[model samples]
Target: MAGGFRRSGQQRQPKLQGKGTLEKMEREGPFKEWLGMPDLYRHTLVIDGDTYTYQVEDAELPFAPGDKVVFRYKEVKSGKWIDRNSLGTWIDPSTYNQ
Candidate 1:
């Protein structure tokens, strides 16, 4: 699926409120490892000068090289794995002012 905005199903309540492309920050520091369902297709993302490939259920994410994503994760102690869902607003590096 091409990167773009995605509308949630009418049945479920929307978690995020906004229109157009939204951006968020990852102030929690770098992630140890990215996680997603195996069946989901993987997408490439660049954050903090690092290239990371991630798989997400929603395809409408505005992800591109050199973009920052606020990564949210769930720690699983029993399985010995870090599961996380990418969050935050998508920011275009080109447009970001230093």
Candidate 2:
């Protein structure tokens, strides 16, 4: 592997959900070293005064600015969280059980 670490299908942590108004969304790059590599999409969303950023292969988001949304995420660090869904995972409005 590139960094002396074997790559595996590892889930970092259990997914948690949050709700907030969509303050912003920005997408950047299809950055890759080679032509055959997949495009990388960086998604940044500002929600409830906090910034949430992540990158993935897809460019789909469930909410837009000014929209109140319930979404899923997983904490990657002490206070850093990433959307559980590549884009923004949508939660049913009727369910806020978690």
**What RMSD does each model have against the real structure?**
12.7, 7.4
Compared with the true structure, the alpha-carbon lDDT of candidate 2 equals 0.68
lDDT of 2 by residue, 22-84 (tens): 788888776674788888777777888888876677676556798876666776565545664
Clashing pairs in 2: none
lDDT per prediction? Answer: 0.40, 0.68
**Cα error, candidate 1, residue 88 (Å):** 1.7
Q: Can you tell me which runs of candidate 1 are displaced by over 4 Å?
A: 1-39, 63-68, 72-83, 90-98
* lDDT string, candidate 1, 1-98, tens digits: 12333464235322332112222312222333346523444444444543344444544555543444455433235321112364555556787996
Model 1 poorest 10 in a row by lDDT: 17-26
For model 1, what is the alpha-carbon lDDT of residue 79? 21
